[model samples]
Target: MRKFLCTCLLFLLLSVPLDAQELDIFGYFEPQFNLIYLDDNYYQLQSNKLRVDLKSNLGENLEFGANFDWIVYHGKREWNYWNFIPERVTSRYSSARMWRYRFTFDDRSFLDNAYLRFSFPSFDLMVGKQQISLGTGYAWNPTDIFNVKDLSDPTYEQPGHNAIRVDWPLRAGFSLLALYSPESDWESSGKLLRLKGRWQHFDFSITGTETEWGVTDYEYPFVNLFTSHKRRLLGGDFAGELLGLGVWGETAYNFVGDFEDFWELLIGGDYTFDSELYLMLEFYHHSLAKSDYRDYGLNDWLRFFYQEQKSLTRDQVYCLIQYPLTDLLKIGGSTLLSLSDGSIALVPTVLYSFHENIEFTLIGNINIGKEGKAYGSSQGHSLLLRSLVYF
Candidate 1:
């Protein structure tokens, strides 16, 4: 399928007349190295990623765009050490998934974006695989269902999804968005609706999403059960400035069939001083999480690591601080604390710019806690170095 798509894109590029339209080609190359220490074991991994983006205007009201990514991995592979566990695992469509496959697998290539868009006076229509980003939170986005942020690198580009999207501009600084992502049948498809506008001094959005979700239950070491249910999510987010500081809030209420309903909330703010020091803090709460770590079991740990669940604890806090040591170099660090279990993760980072389009980054992560707790001492730490060159 990837080969066929690449051929079609090549054909389009060749058939389109240069005089009629302008084609833009650009992208980047990045290589990253990782050294991890976990459970008294040291592991090394390296990955190189290359991406090429293509964009063109087909006509006055039509446009086409696509991006292709090829990545190669070396060192460690195959880390699923739970063969004794049940085969019943939840699908990663509706919730977050660890994305650890990138580091634990061989080389791969895929298309991240391939879409055609049409513009009109009243609304705009987009079809095929495209990028869908929603919500106002930085590290956590409760109102966003299409993609989940990686807490370690929250601003990285996300994989695209195949869907049909519509954007309609409304009167009085408001707009409406609708999206449909098909599955094997309409009854199990994913759908979303959002109404966004500015009120007073803040920008706000109300969003609703409906989809099917699957989860696996275990009965000790011998029995396992799998169940599917319809899940509905309703949420809203707001971002604005207050008293010389930037503030944002996001919340979501989830209703899962036959399962207990829950609410997730996040509140955050950031400020900068005259000395070029930056500070940011955010607090998150999960109503469905277990309040005691002693109640957690093996199944719960698997679910949390696989990203089928959000967190192992009920409450958490994230704080970040940054300062510029020189014009070409900057230093920063962040701390993630699980308020429920007294576990914490500290990450320090340094960034240097070699040239206008070349840069390097170094990051170190240290986890601290009891042996069996979340972000526990047994998890150890890791260091990562990444270099990027843009074209």
Candidate 2:
């Protein structure tokens, strides 16, 4: 770890020049409200946040940056909540330090990003906490091992990983990257390497990742989220135009320590109408899930909360459409269907732009399913209002 820190420091010193511009500081304020109905119960969340960012040039090639988020949220629920602690699924117990501050009741603050980066004509390097987003699948990303985003709220940015990344270009359409995310216990760290290229009209990439996950309380029940096993991931993705439609695919094969190997796959396509309307459809399958998992007891949900499992269903499909009704108003909607349990969730949204830097959105989520099916048991209906301001 010392060597890693020193290497980044050395590069910054060598890359910075004598003269550079002043630091740039800016951010935005956002406010949102949500109302959900589940089993005739009402739950709501009202949130307001202030984000501030600072970026300064160490020189022409080097830079320093950081961002902080302060949020205040309030809501009421009809039922009690569980899942205490923080970042149970992903956070390594043997991390360097806790980089957050919070009062879960109403106020929360944290430094979301802090990093040093060096840019060059041919290659670039970045160190510190940063988001690693890879893959092409819209609803599901089997190739994005570093980022496991929530399917319901797919566009939100999850927590960043602490790592050092080196990106180099091999040619006009070929490149590769190497990344290392170290932990206090080296054995639990993650390493990844990826290669990307193009052939004909298609773009493709192959990646290998090494991961060590810690077991959580849900796994052992009596224990904490600290025990885990090592696993290796081999994944690839491809995207291109097919039959006059945008087509993409992603797949990943996982090799666990002592368990049977499993795989995940996603295939999707999209089309546009006169550049005004867009439509997309996708299918995803997870080999690790049982095709007939009808025992929807508390234990199953516990497994999900404990990070001991992935999806509950083996097969699923998603469809979405977006169109602009006028110069200031737009509409979009999506539906997710779980093939295994024959459950479906529908979300419709509307966006209105009052100015270039300000916008408002209204969203609705509705779920339908059998008593013991995937979508069958959800917060029946939800309504949300989101507004954003940029400065």
Candidate 3:
């Protein structure tokens, strides 16, 4: 999924002069193209996404807001590939699928977020499909359980979840959060609570959640793709500055009914030098992962892909850097390594802002390592070209 938005929205609303009580509308459209090279084969992927967002002040204390997405996607192959599918792809209230023509697979319309809010001096109440994203990590998040992220490109747009949340502010830097999200058929509903605050220069949050998982039957496979299991998650995150450097971390422990407890931890820091160059490094460990790929057979892989486990492999680190070359152009890259098997993936990217309403991006990914290792086994290179327009 993606996490892009909020960049030019404010400008869009203010740039167009409007009456005091007039509703404000803004959105963007992006056409993305990808050429995938893997295992001596090549494939093309393309999709166009459009989102329309609108909001109106119901009164001083109440607001109504909604956004809908219309996406048309077609690729050389079906997106049924495990890695391409999201962990929580379906919801109880989402019934917008239509017109099944299997030339490939795609959906016409998606209801991303539609919510209403009533704000007070201390608290606010929100209901409907919305984003309840939480975390402090950049590349990987061990504590953002509400919406699992694809850290491959953290700046892109992603889908939101259907949930209800209440936020309360206590002191200057202290607040409280509570959220509830239900599964499509009540199979994986859950509740979350977090107490967040800041002391001195450090911002911190402690979170707890109880949820159920919908497990598929190994015996019947696709016939019984749904079952039940309970789990609990306890975690926290902190981000602050350390001696002129940016420091952050996140940790989470899982208690699954059928398996032993497992946990992951990420620690990292970022330092910028010469005013134009920024760099960051992070290291993480997974308690449940093994070194050998054979040990992580089909069932084990499914668990991790579905986020029953937090990571695809264990013992990893990341390095990311960015530099702006000019007023409208920038270059960036990132590298990820699997310390367990010494596999690594490298990504190089170029970004150009043609205008305030248009942009272009080019990126390439290269994987290197021995066979059977995490990034090594998936060794190949691919390029992506994306165009974005705001209207």
Estimate every model's Cα lDDT from 0 to 1.
0.79, 0.75, 0.72
Misplaced by over 4 Å in model 2 are: 1-19, 77-106, 215-226, 297-299, 303-310
Candidate 3's residue-wise lDDT over 1-391, tens digit each? 0111233333334554455446779888988898988657888988888989978775676665778898787686473333322223212112232111113546578768766676988899876668767778887777776665555676565567767789999888899999887664444687889999998999999988878755543224333255666778899999999999999999989787885677889999999898689899999888877666545444445555555555667888888899999989999998888888687888888889999999998888887765545665454568889888988
Candidate 2's error at 157, in angstroms? Answer: 2.1
Runs in model 3 lying further than 4 Å from the true structure = 1-21, 79-105, 183-188, 215-226, 306-308, 377-379
> Which tens-of-lDDT digit does each residue in 114-140 have in candidate 1?
987889999999876888898888888
Q: Candidate 3 — what's its lDDT?
A: 0.72
Identify the leading candidate in terms of TM-score.
1
Q: What is the TM-score of each candidate against the true structure?
A: 0.88, 0.85, 0.84
Model 2 per-residue lDDT tens digits across residues 1-391: 7467657765765656646646689888889899977656777888998888888888778777767889988785223212222233224333322222112445779877778888989998988877788888887788676666565567877666788899999987899999999887767789889999999999999989888754344323333344567878999999999889999999999887865577899999999999789999999998876566454433344444344555667899989888999989999988988888788988898989989889998888877665456565443678889898877
RMSD of 3: 8.0
Order by lDDT, highest first? 1, 2, 3
